[model samples]
Target: MSAIASSTRVLVIGGGPAGATASTLLARNGFDVTLIEKEIFPRYHIGETLLVSVQPIINLLGAREKADAMQFQKKAGVLWQWGGEEWTFDWTKLNCDFTSSFHVKRERFDEMLLRHAQSQGVKVHEGVSISEIHFKGDRPVSADWHEEGSGEAGRIEFDYLIDTSGRAGIMANKYLKSRRFLKAFQNVAVWAYWKGGKRPETGFEGPLTLVSVPDGWIWYIPIEEDVHSVGLVCHSEAFKESKTKESVEELYQRNLAASPLIADLLKPADKVSAMYVERDYSYSSDRLAGPGYFLSGDAGCFIDPLLSSGVHLAMHSGTMAAACLASVMRGEVSEERATRFYHKCYRAHFVRWAVMVSTFYDVNNKKETAFWRAQTLSKEDLQGAEWTDLKPAFSTLMSGLIDMRDAQDSDLLSQTKSRLDTVLQQIRDNHPAPNDRFYRNGEEKFDWGRRPENAIDGLYCTYEPKLGLVDTGPTERAFAAVESSPAAE
Candidate 1:
């Protein structure tokens, strides 16, 4: 075994956000960290929109300034169109500094992360591929990988193994074999970048919008230099249905034409990149960590990118993993305790986001097409998820509550319970339900008034499964109690 006598040697596989963020935090905290990436930086990636929840992570990593330096557009919140009404989820309503985040260019954003991790003393390598991992009883002991083209190979022993290889899941998939895909979020996305689109004129200049179309929804994001990130998420069956008739590009065009609102918006724009399509993308692993191994970021779970939860979760998990492992190394907590805490923290967020995203797929566009039905969940699905007795509408979830790292922050828990109660009451009272963020399109100006309430509760939010609502309030209090306890045991 290559285990050291003094310090913990951590090998983080994958150089994306998760691996980069984890390795960076670990290295900063004095752990010997090595990060390997098969692909070099300045790479292309999707999931361009970001949520406010990621601000803390970005600030923690000291990347907020770097991001600001890059001049990516500042995203205030999300504006979405469902059925025929358009509304916005303003982050400012949360009354926090992170009310604003960025819509980044993935190539630049990723390279910055890896470089920052390197600056923090992580031995980061690019163009390297992992060949094998030797483990003993779920605990990885060593790993082997080779550099690109040189054929030069190296083996490193580790006290811990972290897989942040994104959807590839690297060690989590090949060695552990514990991946599980949620049927509700099985989706396919086809997207491309556009130049010269009808850019937002003023207050809404940099926000992201989700427009519901016939068989899928379109993501219209504003990027730098008059460029826009436009993509469509089609129901898996709808995608296949289109695929059987024409080429992917042709299918996309057919849908694009059908999307007159988006088409009119993009009329003056030019395609800057070829259309790219990815299918069957959302999934999660059985458990985050066991023994001496851990899963971070996309390796742990990837929710549907509808609310731009991808980067936020990756950053949160990576940072949380670092904090948990740091506690173990510092003797503040036992390894078993750390593992349990990590599992609880990681799984709770993933499962919570999974359940929340599933609710969105129950698209209330009044259309029963394959894209809508296949992407949606019925009352049975909601009952199966058991959202809660209060059924809090699960709206603010996309606003970033589930990603908090301190599992036991009493103030956070209290705030969460209070917010859930308030939201639940709003749903029941039907008191305008805070449509202050709604912006009607096809109009001469932005509509600052409250829009009509479009609650998806009976259909997907509060299905009465065999058991009544799970009553997440108690569970929330339980976590709060554990956190506030002196021993936290």
Candidate 2:
């Protein structure tokens, strides 16, 4: 054991949003935190868009003024083009009016966050790799560390460990194994940044634009000035057919030609970053944490990015993990209790988002083509309570409550619930339920109209899966009960 100490204040791996945010928060609280990152700052990252909900967290970190000074892209809200409709919602209408949603240049944004954390007294180590985690049970007291370019090995022991490693890392992969492959979101995304890309006219500027075609959708996000983040997220099958021996750049051009909307945008743009494609990119986790180890951000889970839930969920988890770790440090709760509480919080928010995303795969909405049809109808088996209650309402509202193409009005709330309720009833009416993992108490409620008490519950719905369903009177009551409860036992 290299430099084995009796206890460590907190050891955080990965310097992305979750790791950076957690370290910043904990350091601000006067804790000894060491944050390790393999990649150097100003590195390129794909997810550059943020939701309006992040305003509060940004405000908490006091980054609002600085971000504004940097001239970040301001957004009114998300304009989603899906299910044959183009709908827009001003998230400012959802109480995040102080700041606009952002289209960030990740190179700048991530560097800013890391620098901000350092300014707040966080101990940040860059260009270091944590080779392996060595723990006695769930309390990871030591981690083997090494310099990226050298053969030297070292170790540091800590009392608490936070795995914010983003995407299947440490606590999430080895301990919690929380990553779950939700069949509904079976797609691949090829993303690259382009300089001198199309910029919309003033007042028409938006951070996120969803251009939906038959098989899948393409996300067009403009970041910084003249540099836009473009990615094509398509069903796996659609992607394979277009695969060729050509370079990613060539494939990018060919793929863009598949959709006129994307083609028009790329006509004048030049690729600024290498094109990378990630398959089976959608996943959830088995749990968020246990004992001395906790998972945060993408380390815990990542729902489909269709709604741009990526950054928001990661930020939410980072905040939640920091609080849980603090509780353990203060002796206010046992490590086991803290883990359970964190897990509950993690699931509450994500479950709702997952269900909502799955609805896009529902082919029954009358799209033209077998590919779109199979993608949508394939989601029929997704009729669990989380799918029924929360998805319909979320999708209905997120999709503008009605397709912008025509005036055929439908009560999005009632229609969604009726369809969801029918599915729930059918599952309940069946002889043998598929599995309890996919099911939750139908009695619970969720108030999407308002943010929930804790970031985890408010974001994932991992604890009371029912909390992801329905936003209104019942959800309000349900949220109160869960919030009032003493941290999970």
Candidate 3:
């Protein structure tokens, strides 16, 4: 073997949840893993609300105890505001392992994950940026990078390269040249942090609140130390046309004021940070792996933030990438086969998420404006397509369920599913008739239309965090063409 290939060295770019997770899992599996991050730790990031789906992933990483120690606000469930009414549901309804997930401060949460990776024997260096990844033949040989503030340059070789680069898509943009943005959720966000913001009733950390308006929706997430992270989401049209001559900050404040509930919550708080702008909320990379490299999380694709799926996707993708790469390193899986698996699972989750995002917008009944109008995925909106199963069916995926079941957790998952189904049936028996205003098909109308997309009669929830391998519900429900039917696994 060449000197570079002699060591099972892995270098992960970006220290976000995905990168930290991938490196940690890789190192735990006995691979020599290193992580490169551009920024120092404890940096600010959005996506503070976590779904119940991340419980096992955290437990798998041995951070369940660590997370429990951190004392983040406990989220009993989600509290959503739609059509002038509010309802709350607990994770017990889904048989989640934890009584509650967390409402985290991303800066602290990410740092914890990175530090946990460091604890697992993964080499980590921050304040260093990768200038370029040099390739030999089709495989990456080395990466050229330097310290953030210094001119001193350095180069390092690796046996495999993993990109958990988040939305930057360092490898996807620099090497593969394959990223396509989805117009359906093509949107931007205006947000800021506020100290002394309102909290949910004292017993729980969340009921992470989502309030939808005519232009778009607003998120009210309680983070650390009695602070709340608030944001507004809008498509490009609403961002530009709705704002007109207003600056981004004004737009943010204006939109915040426009919503009565959010306005009431923020009225007593003080803005702790400048209003921020984030554009292009949705996109997908065409490929996940090439030659000696792999992509995970936002490196591969980004879905809308409505579901708070960003962190889960990142960490899940990273862990999955680590597993796939580890399989090849152990000679347990061929790279050809592994790459195919990565691509399939990565894209599957992305497509499923995209469909979910579309349905979030589809639930808007108040306005027929361009902004809200574009969120629906009707046959005309899909351009002559037929998708049967976009309707929400269960709450399992809200926590970011993967399609595949892990062998180790098979028994536990079975028990969880059985209990979850029991609760689901109880709800089904009491579920009121479908609301006529939103009922297009024979589908049962849910609050926010949030349910399982392809809920198995009792078995269809996605299990693993990495592979989007969802059960197709019997064999007949799988979709083949996306432009036509996007409702399959």
Candidate 4:
């Protein structure tokens, strides 16, 4: 391992995808990383669908082959039936190299990532909980921990902390007290697993099927050839009103009955799991990073599941947090700069999704329904907001492009427009004779040669010599290669 100061130790809370990704990358970069989880392996989890972007992070961890070996259902894109409109988002239609993701059993998938972190030299302790975090003024210095069963207690001191504590955010909720729930997305989700649901006949083999109902929407995800995960999302008020009259199972069944598409798909299927309900799942923290800690994954923020972006945000934020800390430890960037970059970049990603999701809710044809109207973003909601107009942001997000520009830029909107123009020019330059059918029918394939861009604040992520941020200047790009075993043994 490279000679990182022996005193510098990193603690990662929660062994889920975010914690595992951050811990694995930091350990591979020669940092002393210890990860603690409140639960053991193969625990049940939701948000099983993934985006194409996750494949690159998996490659950076050198776990592509291992992920492939899991044999999760490959997800090509999503099929949407909104109100009376029918459309699809096929990944292959985009100008990107990676064109597919997966529909995983999250229990198995999360365990694989956690085990991968251990193999990469991350000290992991499962069935352990962080009871308290000891801080020196504004910076966290140590934490009090207790094992689940035996009740053994101990204190662990660390130089830096990465909080991937999913939803049970120790720092954000306990210390920082900065989490803020979005009223527009105050919704409830009830889901169950089924066997033998019919696959979509119109889209790719494993596309996520989304159908909008009068009150909310439904998601049909294929987990295995015969097993599927089905869920319903509705406004919280509607859910509460319905609960006053019927059981949760009855409410779910009534909503499912309202969707003709879902009813037909599950006509011959058997419900195989008990109903699971999650309330008000959309939230964001006023802060994502602080004096000596960074909040990653659900610890920092969580958006609605409309786009299946939960895992994508978790893994992406975890990687970004690890890179920020790695750069700080290597003396490649100041702690302040790294913290600012992480907070801005991660929050921008979250906000973009939030805006897009709210806009998507507005597009549902059931505007006449109280449930749908309550979820829609009104003009007053967008007044003076960072993203006032949702059209360009929606297009940019749908294109799957990463914008690393500083969120505080005075001309951010103009810069974003220019960036989108540049992307289109690159696409045209690469494909001089682009297929018209690709635009009209979403059937053609092309490459976008999408590469990471330097943030306006002079930092960008690189994966060649190591996985971390480096100065945009040429002098600091020559990163030293630390000797270590491949992330996947």
Best by TM-score: 4
**lDDT by residue for model 3 (89-173), tens:** 5454443345567899889888989999989988887887888988888888788878767665678888899988777788888
Give lDDT per model, in order.
0.66, 0.62, 0.66, 0.74
* Number of clashing residue pairs, candidate 2: 24
Per-residue C-alpha lDDT of model 1 across residues 271-382, encoded as one tens digit per residue = 9998888874667777788898789888888878876788888876787678667766767556776675566546655655654455455434357776776654333322
136 Cα displacement, candidate 1 (Å) = 1.7
Taking the candidates one at a time, how many backbone clashes does each contain?
A: 0, 24, 10, 1
Error of model 3, residue 131, in angstroms = 1.0
Candidate 2 off by > 4 Å: 1-7, 95-99, 175-178, 199-204, 244-251, 271-274, 363-489
Off by over 4 Å in 3: 1-8, 200-204, 377-489
TM-scores, all candidates, are 0.78, 0.76, 0.76, 0.83
Task: Give the least accurate 10-residue stretch of model 2, judged by summed lDDT.
Answer: 463-472
lDDT of 4: 0.74
Q: Candidate 2 residues 46-126, lDDT tens each? A: 787887556656665667787677678887665555555454554444322343568887788888888898898878878
Enumerate residue pairs that collide in model 3: 53-399, 392-451, 393-451, 393-452, 394-451, 394-452, 402-463, 403-469, 403-470, 456-460
Query: Which scores greater on lDDT, model 3 or model 4?
Result: 4
Lowest summed-lDDT stretch of 10 residues in model 1? Answer: 460-469
Which runs in model 1 stand beyond 4 Å of their true positions? 1-8, 200-202, 363-365, 377-489
Which of candidates 1 and 4 reaches a greater TM-score? 4
Error of 2 at 217 (Å): 1.0
